[model samples]
Target chain A: MTASTAGPFDTERTRSVRGASWTAFRAMLLRDFTILDKRLPQFVAGTVMQPLMLVFVLTNLFPRIGQAVGGGGGASRFSSLLMAGIVAQTIIFIGIFSVGTEMVRELGVTGEVEDRILAPTPIFVVAAEKIVSGGLQALFGAMVVFPIGAFVPSTPVYLEVRPIVLLTLTPLACVTAAALGLTMGARFSPGTASYLFGVVALPLSFLGAIFYTWPSLDAVPLLQYALLVNPLVYASEGFRAALVAGEPHLSLFVVYPAMIVSAVVFTVLGMRGLRERVLS
Target chain B: MFLVPRLQQTPGWLSRPDISILRPRMHSLPPANISRPGGTVTLASEGESAGNGATPHPGAADVISTTALKKVYPGGMVAVDELSLSVRRGEIFGLLGPNGAGKSTTVGMLTTRVIPTSGSAVVNGIDVVAEPARAKQVIGVVSQANTLDQGLNVWENLYFHGRYFGMSAQASRAATNDLLERFRLADKKTAEVEALSGGMARRLMVARALLHQPAVIFLDEPTVGLDPQSRIALWEVLGELQDEGQTVLVTTHRMEEADEHCDRLAIMDHGRIKAVDTPAGLKARLGGGASVTVRADGEIEKLASQLRRAVFTTEVQVVDGHVRISLPQAEGAMQLVLAAAQAGRFRLTDLAVSCDNLETVFVKLTGKDLRE
Candidate 1:
């Protein structure tokens, strides 16, 4: 039998790795957004309700009922602080909660995630698609929270909004939060995911320096330094520096670098966790 | 080629040479050669001469080849053990085994869903363990469970799957429509997967897998829960795919399905293959005769022993409330057994004679029913 020079198999159907990865990424992102679009009412309600309630009760109802947060001129000052903080908190919670819960469902015994994993792309790209889609939702969550925080409170709120800073810092904050969500989502089981709100989300909000400025916690220096571990703290401080000026807060140099570092760290960890979980 | 040693002693009915024992070492064959008659190429290893005897041609390039592929889960549970097999291009190959037989694990390893603990698996010439993403490009997998996106319609599922393989929007849409029609799901294109019936969902899963036109398609129990009509329909589809030169590797517990659909099959049990051959070849290994089943009220063990000693009987076993005997010729053996029974005063309540097939071979080899 003479050896044949023809190729072992046809290559027409095979795809370039780079092209396939890009296509798979776009398809995954589109799938998530399509689902979100179908569930828009639920999305809006879930994203808007918590932040609105927080602003209404803490900023508006508290002072109206003669229970001012701080002291003289303190209610209005606290309102502005609450406004920026609520936006930051809303973004973080939406990122972590949304991605983590969805991941729990996807990684279950009978999961549709199997289809996604079969795509002709590296597993890390699948993880990244989840994070990017989650981040986009977080950005939307921030937008929804902003208007509610601006008008719902009874106090006349004063804000100094910087367009460039807001645009730059908001995306960074959302990405970091979403990356953290990806990591937690891969790490936790569905049964354990519910505990995330109580154990992680609630504590993050309180210790995130949302109720007061990071520098203003000078009276409690240890708590201030410890709260630095929370990514939400950087988000709150970044928004405070942008929307409320002359307030004691972390400088832009610290906030921006910290947010960038956190985003990178969480993203790396999340991808690794996702790969392990999927391949195991 | 490797030759399995023959049994030292044989009954009169089982005097045929065991040709099925010789397994071809296709992995050691020379690279792709010119297609010979029968679309096969004969390549000899160092220890064997090419023209010494008739060897089945290694037809087409191997689509999937695994050597000593092993997977050990945490806590040291071995899912697949030293599994070495080769699936040729453009053939319907069946992996036959009962539940918990590691068929799923082998599929998982080859499909890149579960990582192997040691050794290697190559799918469509790409090493699955080393480059799973690339391997995935050439293979489509339809898992046993329903994996269709519940949130999306049938068309969207196919479209997204095509896009994942890097197809353009126009191409994806065209492929989706074509596959929907081919799978008889065009009417359900806009219907959510959650609303589809069990058979429709299964068909949709297959349509989704074929969207990218993969070289090899793995179907894990494709008809596990389908009705008889659905199973027949799926069988026709699989036959068409094979005719179109699509290499299909399927895992199924149904002996009838394997016999009807697979070009060749490997019977796997306890993470190991007991035998591999065509359905007819494997059946021939079990004495190549007819089976006589006698259900009597007397001592079944004594009757089986007596039948085993008969000149025409090759083997006898009592199972499921009947004494099954294998004989070279059913006509003569049945008369002789009936005369002997009448002479011995052994009353027979029922008797049946049928040709030996894959199920008989499976029972003879594994000593258990296929369903068990």
Candidate 2:
């Protein structure tokens, strides 16, 4: 047998691993978007349908009854409040429930979460990227709901459009929704997550200023403060301040900074939970 | 738990001299047939020095090596125990075992999904326990469960995996297209993976694993639930991968698959390896021999004892209704075996000797059938 010499194969092989780090991270992000994109229709349905139904059902029901039955001309203003609150509510609900449920199912049925955990980037990046994509979806859902809300009757209190407030609060609200979803999604097992969606999400929606304003509930101090703790409260209130400046609105000072701070807190919690879940 | 630290604490083979420090513990067996030939196959040279120690062919560096690798679930079940193995560059190695065996656990540890209770592995020369990200980057894993995004199309699945490996969008697209073309899946690229047959999904998983062109690939029962034709098609694909100089470690319970596809294999049971060798090397070491099966009336174990003592036979054992014995060759040996069985008061119904197979090797070593 003609046995040849050594090193050629080994040296040439080692030289082949010339790949870079950035290329890997980009690949992971692209993959996440591809998966999210496929669920686009369901996202649009939840975002547009839920808010539109709430606005139309509430707005039309008001005028059929006289001022005495519908709480006077302010019925129109209340519908406007309902419109803004519902838009915020849909974004928060869709982002948290949709993203969280998907995560739970992914962790359950297929162990698809293993794909991200095993990717080249740190596990934290994978968690953040998934939430970021969820936030983007939330933004699109909110945008779609606003135009549809215009068709509702009762001369709804029109939006005034404060650029500074809208620009700051909208993204913050989206991030907060996503991060909240991430924290719960990573922590809960899939079996009990539907219960969370029904009990937790619905309750959070009610307490977080989706159907009413904060000062209107001033008689119940505990409820007002308790609702204040819900991130959706700050989001809806902040949107109200931006979209209807002349109307009864929560002060921009409290709503704007609170929205930003809550987003940061949720992001931190999501990052930590995600890191633990992936690494463990 | 003890095995995990031992694997991780020990340096890699390149730095450590004691390659066999995590040597597999032997289970008690009936005393070896003292009348028959017995020799220890030198799996590795004993006194070889560290680092520059001559490895018969210090040729291609090992793509993956585990040192005292172990995994123990919280419920006190030890799935994998002190597994030490080395897969060289460009070789297709198989972990062959039965149901509930730790083949999947061992694969999980190597792939960095399930954290080991102890030990460590270096995959593609990166310390898996110490630097999992680096190790992950170099290895591609096809798990027993389907991880494809069912919502996305086949091309998207391939593209995403490529992107996750950090390839550019254009690069991923190119790789996805090439893989689709190679797997003959180009026509079905736009279809959802959920709509594909089991075989198609499996082939796509393989294509996905190959997108980044990982240096080491872990295939855990890649063709487990496929139909016969699909199983063979996967076999050809795996062979092609081996031919392309990629190192692959596959775990499977299918004896024929392992026999046909593996360059080397380890037969595992009860969380340990019973035997490891090239398919032919294992059989030849059993001796270039054939196994005789004689189904007879009366107590088969008694016949087995009698056949063992007979001068005509080399080794004998009772397996179900038959007295199985191995001989160097079949021609004259079978007649002698049958004559001995007749003298032993055994009424033989069916007697035949067939060439040795992987199934026979597993049974001979583990005292149980692979399907068990």
Give the range of the ten consecutive residues with the poorest summed lDDT in model 2 chain A: A1-10
My TM-score estimates for the predictions, one after another, are: 0.83, 0.79
lDDT of each: 0.78, 0.70
Best by DockQ: 1
iRMS values in order, in angstroms? 11.0, 12.4
lDDT of 1 by residue, B1-372 (tens): 211121111112122333123222233334433242322321211111122212232455567778788889999988788887767766788998777778999999999989999988988667889888877887898988898887778889988887777776777787787778888999999998889988898888887887776768999999989999888888888887776566799999899989887877777777777666666656655436777888887888877777776644667889987888878754476786787666667799998888767777777766664444
TM-score chain B for all models.
0.73, 0.71
Q: What share of the true interface contacts does each candidate keep?
A: 0.51, 0.37
Score candidate 1 by lDDT.
0.78
TM-score of 1: 0.83
Per-prediction DockQ: 0.35, 0.33
lDDT of 2 at A246: 53
Model 1, A1-280: lDDT tens digits are 2322112553433566777899899999988998899989999999999988888998889989989585455778888888889999988998778988778777764578888899999999999899899999999989888999889988877799888889999989988888898888888888898888999899999999888888888889899899999999999999998898557779889999999999999999999988888886
